[model samples]
Target chain A: MNIFASLSRKPWIWSFVAAFVVWIATILFTGGTSAIGLSQAALTFAAFSILVGIGQMFVITLGPGNIDLCVPATMTLAGTIALKFMQVDNSLILPGLVVAVAIGAVVGMGNFALIKLLQIPPIIATLSMSFIVQSTAIWTNRGLRIKPPQALAKFTTETTIGIPHVALVALVLSVFAFILLQKTVYGRWIAAIGQSNRAARMAGIPVDGTRFVTYILCAVLAAFCGYLLASFSGGAALNMGSEYLLMSIAVVVIGGTAVAGGNSNVAGIWGASLFMFLVVSMLNTYGAGAGIRLIMTGLIIIAVIVAAGGRNPNQR
Target chain B: MKRALPSDSIRLLIPALSLTILLIAVFYLQPRAMSYVGLNLLFNLAVPIALATIAQMLIMTVNDLDLSMGTFVSFVACVAATFLQATPVIGVLILVAAIATYAALGVLIHVRTLPSIVVTLGMSFVWGGLAVLILPAPGGHAPEWARAVMISRPPLVPMAIIACVVIAMVAHFVIMRSSIGVILRGVGGNARSVERAGWSILGARAATYALAAFFAILAGISLVGLTTSADANIALRYTLLSIAGVILGGGEFTGGRVSPIGAVIGALTLTLAGSFLSFLRISPDWQIGAQGAILIVVLGLRLLLNRLENREKRS
Candidate 1:
């Protein structure tokens, strides 16, 4: 009874349960031959989603009116600009990383300024910011597929002790996020703010500063995902970050984070990300047509939410 | 009721101001657009977008949103192009079912307390998939009636402008002046009080969603009429476009605050902004960015107005 209650309280367990079920089902399709390969591949792709997903989760935790719609645009700009700066020079990889995060920080500040200074809704502010960033990316890309440095590409693709390098990098970041959320004062401040902005202010929390930093952290994570993704895929493409917008949100919601805000979990993000990748691959492996695949994906998302999300308070 | 509606006069002025500025810019860039024929060409596409904006406006009225609007419109367009053109009865049935599905979604969101964005995002995939199944490619022809209705040339003014006027008036009467509209907006302002008044929040939500679905269906048919064909992704951007239009028209995200006439003008202004940019010979790549810039500038103006209003209140 105690274990069951604890499990129920941990919203992320559901996503992990779903992910494991999907993984097993996929393995069954291959008659157990593709288990290791499937797991590795799932982990590899899930890493990218996890990277962006962590960022989105933090923003979503800030409450109902808060969300970051510029993840894809930020990713594109960082990847494109960073790769261009590197020019395939291995020595420039550190600079490239700094450039991506710095761009993310700048975008974050801009997004917050629009919301705070101009009083625009976060949705509109991020969306409009995304458009400008997308344009900059287009201008920078100029139809070029600038490749990453030779060593970085090898590092992204190759495994360290049988774990894909990218997945390890994602794991490290995940740990960092977990620490920030659980073991830090910043995490508590954000949760308090999300629960009730007025109450948080009364409690002497620095609401605006915390909110600002959260946006910056989220953007920085997105940029990191872009930089790593560009390196992993051998180059940057203008449309590269597009798929991630939905992926990040899906993992957070499906992973069982409260959509109403004030509560979030790091583990669920990983589980949901893995499940998303596996589900797609499974549907593809089953010879399902694109239409069927999309329909099933949609239905599954609804089912998970209805089953789990219905337990939360009703929010418009 | 007064609180439910924001500063109404100022709200109207902001959208009108932006529209006039964009219109002047477009005229300066391309003198031909000043004429009836040129104006028609520029605004024909805005008609469908205008309808979609109204649909989004209704959802906003109830403080819920529909992210699947684009895919839903795409699905309806596919049905109109293929099935409606081939057999009217089946097409009508499908559209009716789609509208009912939208109503059901509203009830589901309300009953389960599910976030509309997540549920609608899921529905977007389902609708997109169904659209693909209905029209595997972009080759299906639109129904002849739809084509004729869209191409019908009215006298003295362009068909686009006439459609906009009619749509704006109808939406205004239905959403702003009607009893149901009042009650729904009340739900957005304070659902608890509305409930205390013995109104069913569920019913209001369903009605609002159903009405939005009706407008979106019309948008889809009109879009197909213009293109004479349909694809699964035909109106994918309409989701974002509709949301942006609603915001541009002075619709707030959470409040029941929305203006039908303002929304119509907002959609037209967006279409005109695109035309203005293209006439400036801006690269296709930067055109989207320019739209974003325009949105920001207009919103910044809103800030200025807001500050003035605040100062006046204080004084």
Candidate 2:
């Protein structure tokens, strides 16, 4: 009864219901004609969306001001770094992953420092940092494309049984992140600080450090997703990360995570990710190109935000 | 009795200093870059963005963002270009109609009390899509007379500079003298308090957004003149640039304060910066990176100055 009540209380459950309806509509319309192909596409997009959503959730649940504009750039920079490293030496695959994650951490730390030291508003600071990171990525790439490494490519493509590799990776990461957020002391601190930094500080929580770590963790995860993205897309482009910005925020909102921080629903986030993918896939299947797809996506996000209310209770 | 300078006065001074420093840097680096012709070009480039930034600043002062300004601008430009291809008068009518329609939409969203960011962003996408539909490949041209009027300079000074000054003065008047302006600042500072005072938050927000759309339309027309042709992609850069300008000009995104003149000056600074980079023959990619870097640095410096001022006052 308690579990059911909790599930019912989850805001993202409503989003999931919406997603399920769309999934059913998609399946009915397609009539199993391209079931395997549809599933593959859906899985890949869902995984990518989930990873990005997870990163957003962390920042939304942490930060003095509950907003993050650096997710896309951080992800892109990480991907760019990973790709560049892999291109130079095939033996540096593991090192490349570490370096990519580290780059994300550095970017997050940079934002954290700015917010803490300079007292720049969170949204503005993150936004400016995002621009910087994006520019850096563009500059590093020298207005050219960087191909994905072969080993990483194989890892992302190789699947076991019926499940896709990307989906599996997403699942593992989500579960791990969920556990980290729910069961750990740091998780409790995150929630506490998010609720009231003053109270958290009174309770002896390292508020600034926690926020810094949260941002770093978020950036690292986003970067990891970017790596996965590069592997899937086979190459990294300059504006590759920009698309993820809105999608990630939308997923977080749909997943029942408020932008103001404190509350989070990992399961709901995963469901939202799946729902977003299903919607996009359905739209694409119906012959909607990039422009239409973008418009529809924007509309759906707006609708969801309206339904959820303008201010998230958890937001600072 | 001793009194500290008003916040507004300090706000004005910062932008003035920033602009002066920017001009000095440009002149020092390249002495010949300060020609009348070059200044005219800079004014032309800054005017549209300055108008858009003013619009953005109004919304931001109310603690709202208008992400759709660029798209709205593009849509209006496309409409004006298509309907007024041969007649400048028709183009003016189309522009007014477009602005009115967008303002009505703004009112609708405000009345609903929806999140401005999400609503405007969605609206922008819809408008952008419509623009693409209107001019699929960007071949249609604005009437030659209209274009000439938009880009032409007066005998004594550039028309663009005059437009900037006139618009800034009008905006300053509207923001400082009007009851609606006071109400906007009040609402931006604290909506709950304003509501408690029996004021309609929606009314204030709607008016600001409508004003923003009006400016956006004017900007769109100017952009059409600059490019000669209506392209769907023309206004995309304006979205970020306007916000950057507003912030750099000491306009807070969360409602309460605005500096229209500051915003214009910020726009001018951005234009000058871009031109200076172009003069150095920097690639497009490098230019973007440099612009981003400069904005971040400027914002950082602004924050540092604000902190110091606050501390000094406290002391």
How accurate locally, in lDDT, is each candidate? 0.90, 0.77
Runs of candidate 1 exceeding 4 Å displacement: A312-316, B1-6
True contacts kept of each: 0.65, 0.34
- The residue-by-residue lDDT of candidate 2 on B200-308, one tens digit each, is 8877776777788788877877777888888777788787778878877878766587888888888887887787677667777677667766666777677777888
Judge candidate 2 at residue B310 and give its lDDT.
83
lDDT of 1 by residue, A1-316 (tens): 9998888767888889899999999999989999988889999999999999999989999887788989999999999999999999999999999999999999999899888887888888998899999999999899989999999999999887778999999999999999999899999988888888899999999999998999999899999999999999989999999889878888989988777688888999999999899988999889888888888888888888888865545432
Interface RMSDs of all predictions? 1.5, 3.3
TM-score of each model, in listed order? 0.97, 0.91
lDDT tens per residue, model 1, B1-315: 134345676788888888998888888888888999998999999999999999999998988878888999999999999988999999999999988999999999889888888888889889988988888888799899999988999898999889988999999999889999999899888999999999999999999999999999999999999999999999998988888888888888887988998899889988888888899999998998998888899889877977877787777
* Two-chain DockQ for each candidate model: 0.68, 0.41
Native contacts recovered by candidate 1, as a share? 0.65
Every prediction's TM-score for the first chain? Answer: 0.97, 0.91
